[model samples]
Target: MITVRPSGQRGYADHGWLRAKHSFSFADYYDPAEMGWGALRVINEDRVAPGTGFGRHGHRDMEIVTYILSGALEHQDSLGNGGVIRRGEVQRMTAGKGILHSEFNPSADEEVHLLQIWIEPAVHGTPASYEQQALPVDAMRGRWRLVASPDGADGSATIGQDARLSATVLSPGEALGYALAAGRLGYVHVVRGHLALNGIALAAGDGAKIGEETELHFAADDEAEILLFDLPPTH
Candidate 1:
């Protein structure tokens, strides 16, 4: 079964300095029916104005991942981990027990556009951790590049759960296929351009949930960037 969630239907919050859209319930934008898909708790698309960003914030028992779509995001955490995540980079922070962090735009004039994701940890109170990796464009240009995984397979950043996240960049007429594990599920998020999942078309910011399907396919009408989540269904 495949269910679609259009971009326009997502929750929105525009605070002048921070414009965010929630794919699932988050920070005052609650929707009981759209709580989450599998262990994926949050997918927040955020645009931070130049010279501004999120101040010190706390999180616990969540595996947080940040993907920069454009511009750059400067991050500083209690663990003394500090760095600038530019386009083509993925950063993962495990807030086991608890952690305090801050994210801001590094530019004084260019806006910072990025996606913040939260996935439930398989085990609680493990320990706080952080990981960052640069994903070259050529790596995902025509295939699904594993960016995060439970076993850290394919040189992917390790996450705190039994899930795998893959990203792909495709040109017009390009396609990719994935054979689903018997009981695993898949979630596809279109990040750029237009694409067709199975047969239904999806544009940027759109998401699709697939469960119990034996196979999955994606095709792009033009240049497209997509993120795929392979996860064990959550109860």
Candidate 2:
């Protein structure tokens, strides 16, 4: 089945300095029916105001991934890792054992648009680690580029789970396909522009939860960017 989650239907919160939309139940936004998809626990599309962002926070046993869609976000952690993640860059933090971190918009005049995602680790309570990788525009043009996986496949950032995430930037009329194993599930999240997945139209911020399916085929209606996840079943 392919279940579509419209962008406008997500849980929204505006905190002056931070505007966030939660794809799953998070913080004050709780939906019993929208808990999460498979091992993916959270996907928050956030827009941080100029020179403002999240304060120091602690997390544990979660694989946190951040993708900067626009502007930049400065990250500092108790592990002594600090950097600025700009557009097209993906940062992964294994919050095992425990980790403290802060994310801030460094630009004085520009807001930072980004997606912060959390995935449950297959193994927990291990040492915390961090990694970041940049996806060049050319690599995703008209094709799916693997960005995260359990083993860092294709130079993708390694996660602590049996999940694979792929992203794409397609030109108008371009197509991409992904085949699923018999029992695997999938998820598609539209980041920008417009596209049609298996005849279902999706615009920016839309998502589709797939299960009991075999393959996914998408064609761009215009210039579009999307992220796809091959996930192990929670049941």
Candidate 3:
């Protein structure tokens, strides 16, 4: 079964400095029926204004991952980790027991576009940790690049969950495929441009939930970027 999630239907929050779209409930946007998909808890698409961003906030027992699409995000956390996450970079933080962090756009004039994602930890109260990696365009061009996983395989940043995140960049007419095992579920998020997933059309910001499927296919109609989530059955 394939369920399409149009971008327009997602919850929205425009704080002037932070315009965010919630794929799954986060902050003040809540929907009982739209709680989450399996272990994937939150997917917040954010556009942070230049010179402003999120202040110190706390999180616990969560696998938090941040991806920068454009511009850059400066991060500081309770673990004393601080750095700038540039375009094509991925950052992961394991808030085992608890942790405080802040995200800010370092640019004084250019807005930063990014995604903030959260996954339920496979285990609780381990220890707080952080990791970051910069992916070159070659790594994602025309293929699924594993960016996050349970063990940080292939240099992917480790998460606290039994899930894998693969990212890819596609050009017009480019195609990609993945085998969807019978028991594991799938989620596809188009970051930008138009695409056809198994003949179903999807636009930027669109998402699809895959269940009981045998294969996953993607074709780009224009230059596009996407993230595919191989999710576990626990939410």
* Model 2 lDDT tens row, 177-207: 8898988989889999999999999999999
**Local error of candidate 1 at 207, Å?**
0.4
lDDT of 3 by residue, 1-235 (tens): 9999899989999999999999987789998877878888889999999999889999899999998889999999999999999887899999999999999999999999999999888899979999998777679999989989998898898997889999999999999999876788899989999999999999999999888887988999999999999988642
Q: Per-prediction TM-score, please?
A: 0.98, 0.98, 0.97
Report the alpha-carbon TM-score of model 2 versus the true structure.
0.98
Give the clashing residue pairs of candidate 2, or none: none
Error of 3 at 67 (Å): 0.5
Score residue 198 of candidate 2 by CA lDDT.
Answer: 92
Q: Write the per-residue lDDT of candidate 1 for residues 1-235, one digit (tens) a residue.
A: 9999999999999999999999999989999989989999899999999999999999999999998999999999999999999987899999999999999897989999999999999999989999998877689999989989998888788998999999999999999898889889888889999989999999999999889896998989999999999998756
Model 2 misplaced regions, further than 4 Å: none
The 10 consecutive residues of candidate 1 with the worst lDDT sum are 130-139
Candidate 1 lDDT at 155 equals: 78
Off by over 4 Å in 1: none
User: What is the TM-score (0 to 1) of candidate 3?
Assistant: 0.97
After aligning candidate 1 to the native by TM-score, how far in Å is the CA of 132 from where it should be? 0.7
